[model samples]
Target: MSPRRSRKTSFEDKMARLEAIVEELEKGGLELEKAISLFKEGTKLVEELSEMLRDAEIEIENLYSEDDLNGD
Candidate 1:
């Protein structure tokens, strides 16, 4: 069998995929197994995206802190 498509690492791509999953779930036609799989994948995407945002926030804070020290 062919390999599964790789999950994206970028935050935007993850968000897009998560949104698509949500839309698919909302449409109400998926089999029980498929819905469970999508839900699990969506949960993972949310966790990864949350981590990315947290890292970005920390980076932004560090940049501002440096600017404050430099009187910028």
Candidate 2:
């Protein structure tokens, strides 16, 4: 993959990439180096998505608290 393609990768995009990775792994055609790199990238994607979700949840909770405090 190109550097630009790798940089803009998102949760959904990475999930799709990971699905392709799985299919490739299942098909047993990728070289060891490529497979390892894909696995590492997929791990990064999982962590990135998890952190994004945690931040989103915190924001949602804060918004709810603010609404309650405002007597809305």
Candidate 3:
């Protein structure tokens, strides 16, 4: 599979998981260890999401630059 396709799939999956994590956290009756673990996972997801967004933004910019170069 193409890297782009995989990344898109991963992004979607990560977002869904993150939402689930947030919902679970919000319900708030878990053991302290479990809550902390969920928080850590959520934090990691946020970082990954941010990085993916940055990479996408850069790709978009590059595409526009290429278009300009081609006089499109």
Candidate 4:
């Protein structure tokens, strides 16, 4: 039998794009047109991802920082 997959599919990719967009905006070098477009895209991506997270909850395994991986 195949192992079942976990983690939100494409979730990390969307987050990466959003981070890039914010970085571009913060750089303050983009032309107004490009900045506005990136801002719009970033807002949309944030909303979509927020909705995805809102629909579910998952226990995080904070193995790197805390013992027992958190509030288990």
Q: lDDT for each of the candidates?
A: 0.82, 0.73, 0.91, 0.82
TM-score of decoy 3: 0.71
Model 4 has a clash total of: 0
Off by over 4 Å in 2: 1-9, 55-57, 60-72
State the weakest 10-residue window (summed lDDT) of model 4. 1-10
Could you give me the TM-score of model 4 versus the true structure? 0.64
Which model scores highest in lDDT?
A: 3
Off by over 4 Å in 4: 1-9, 55-72
Q: Which portions of model 3 show Cα errors greater than 4 Å?
A: 55-72
**Candidate 3 positional error at 65, Å:** 16
Model 1, residue 34: C-alpha shift (Å): 0.2
Q: What C-alpha lDDT does candidate 1 achieve relative to the native structure? A: 0.82
Tens-digit lDDT track for model 2 on 1-72? 887767556657867876776777778878999989878877787777677567453333365677588897
Worst lDDT window (10 residues) for model 1?
Answer: 1-10
By lDDT, the better pick of 2 and 3 is 3
- What is the Å distance of residue 42 in model 2 from its true position? 1.1
Candidate 3: 10-residue stretch with minimal lDDT: 55-64
TM-score of 2: 0.51
Q: What would you estimate as the lDDT of candidate 4?
A: 0.82
lDDT of 3 by residue, 1-72 (tens): 999999889999999999999999999999999999999999999999998777443333454676688896
